[model samples]
Target: MTTVADAVGWDGALDALAERIAPRFCRPEARRRAGQYLAGLLAPVERKNGWQLAEVAGDANPDGVQDFLARMRWDAEAVRDDLRGYVVEHLGDSQAVLVLDETGFVKKGTRSVGVQRQYSGTAGRIENCQIGVFLGYAGRLGHALIDRALYLPQAWAGDEERRRAAWVPEAVAFATKPKLGLAMLERALDAGVPCAWVAADSVYGADSVLRQALVRRRIGYVLAVTSGQRLFPGTVSDWVEDVPADGWHRLSAGDGSKGPRLYDWAHLPFRGAPEEWGKGLLIRRRLADGDLTFYFNFAPAGTALKELVRVAGTRWTIESGFELAKGEVGLDQYEVRSWTGWHRHITLAMLALAFLTVVRTAAIGGKGPGRLGRRTSALDRAGDPSPAPPAARPSDPKTRHRYCLVALAKTSPAAGAALSLETPHPNR
Candidate 1:
């Protein structure tokens, strides 16, 4: 019997995601059915991978199913975009931040898409893996991953021999993580999401291309910086008169305006800077918690340091995002292997995470996830059970889907921050 549940079906969420993967890639109904089928087929303890995921998602013959998935134009980015659209629509024009970070997926064998022996944040050591540079956003309504680019390895770029053997596309070139990050910021901007800023760790913050691109695009950014990084504004006169870099620049810190925070400027042109770069105020904030430093080339001098700190702090959302995504959800498990399969699985896992984030935002408020200080009686070896139903997806075509992440934020951590989502028919 063909059955669609009367209440919510986790797979049912896919039915609304037309903004993402074209229906032709995998019929939403079929994909949902395949996913549900797989969910039931896998043992409770089974890993999350395509081999197992395909068992139920597969057709009468397993090989044909494998071939079909590989051949499809679909990739995890498509689903991630779907989840992004859903959450953004729900948010409805509140200020939000998109965070960029690279995650490593460990692979023992050769031939996983973009896998190489490299530094993996997940493993905290050098290992064979594919590094994924991703962009995520969260605000009053919810949070979701928006875009992804596989870190095509330098090996593929340097070796024509391996390039030919691996069929690495000719366009692939040696790009540092920051370069990939710049492209992602551009992608978010191009999508026209209502973003106030971009955030990331020192890896991206230190890269000149990333900071320059954000400045060139006039997109604001906050990123952690290595203590050694230098920043300063272009030469300008004092508040009283136009002056050059040989002048003094200082900023007062704290409520009393007497805090130790201060910076001195060395005015310079965009010339000595990195490519496509503009020169601006550089702030060096030293504190006991840790030393923080960065440069803001585009913002006005009066606001430069504040903007830098705000942008730099935005990285926490993704850091908290990772904490919830990995610990609360089973993101670390590798129950699948195909390039297509791994992404597909991660996409679904992200969907669930997005769903919960929305719930927490709507029902309560989701600023960012916070630790409870100890394991809660609320959590267990069994994964967070599904959360209660959310208000219907918002009706505005501009923003209606991402109740998925609300599911994650709502279920376990309980959205420690304020959720700005409006209730459905509050009058009733």
Candidate 2:
């Protein structure tokens, strides 16, 4: 089972990454602290806040680290662009998916930028928190968060005193969450990040302006839509209500912690469309509770239902990315309250996550340890959904490993070894 991960000289990878992004830091001290900050993020620290991260970075106190985050001269946006380019260069595929989603950062105080008593997905309820809209890149190689925007509610955006206190820029105005996601998508597309489909939850999907923008760009999407979304003449719920039981097809949206996320799916195409471009509605019914979800799909003509389902499943990839970034790289552990500090810390955390993904990809040669019975179902072809028996779950003994190079680098110092630590499935 020894792969490139075992043999490839990965000791210099982080150093090489630091060198690659060195120019982003204007001063030598900033450049040096940047390396330390990234390393601290990668280090096995209990909490990745200023003091703990500083301790991991061998600093006597948190003052330097805090200053680095609060007043660092480096441009977080420029670093974000570098992160986008790096992820694309390593994990890029023309068939890759660009996923948009948001995660909540639970904050106790009102001082944090964009913090409000809003619905926090992280908390699973309405809580005082800041929402960060993120863009994730998912290819056959791997997935990583590449771009991020802090959601600024109108309350914060319009308040001049709070804006001054938080250093919110004058140019930054109130934009909806979907608008933020669209802007990130536009940035990635304009930079030629190379993605085939965009997958997202209904927040973005419900926005006709965003959907129209994607359609105008000729980009495909499998966006979750609310039940009330208009289609042709009748609403989505009305149209899907009449779909015969025989019309439903069983498919896996993607792999989950247990196994394939199997569900019954049905597709209903829009009546009018260009011959080249296909438009449709995709429906998913949970086998356990019969709960339903809907997706508005757009793609080239003759695209298989399997492909659409695959894109639909890709939306979950960003969720996994969020979990990994937050769990592994302090994505949600920042103590910063100001606008600049928030972006800087998040950008660095994202960079750390990207570094891990890239290293893991290189080590494993872009393949999971074992395949979980990848038999193509009989229903994969013919381009429609129907009901079928679920496939038997295979016994996959090996768990997916989270690779950390920092500990290895610490031990080997010269030639970094790979530390393959067992972790729950990324899809969990």
**13-106, model 1: which lDDT tens digit per residue?**
3333322333323445545543442342323435444455445554454453454334434444544655555556565344577788988777
Q: Pick the candidate with the highest TM-score.
A: 2
Candidate 2 lDDT tens digits, 1-428: 55554434343567666766666676788889998999999998888999998898888999999888777577778778878877877788999999999999998989998999999887899999999999999999899999999999999988887887787877789999999999999999998899999999999999988989999999999999988877645567776655544446677778999998888776766534455886777889899998889998888876766788889999888999999998999999998888889999999999999988877776577343222112222223223243332212122221022211111001221221222111122222
Query: What RMSD value applies to candidate 2?
Result: 17.9
Task: State each model's CA lDDT, in order.
Answer: 0.50, 0.79
**Given candidate 2, what's the lDDT at residue 225?**
90
Model 1 Cα displacement at 335 (Å)? 6.0
Candidate 1 runs further than 4 Å off: 1-46, 51-68, 73-80, 92-94, 158-170, 230-308, 327-345, 365-428
Q: In candidate 1, where is summed lDDT lowest over 10 consecutive residues?
A: 400-409
After superposing candidate 2, which stretches have Cα over 4 Å from the reference?
A: 1-8, 366-428
Q: Please state the error at residue 35 of candidate 2 in Å.
A: 0.4
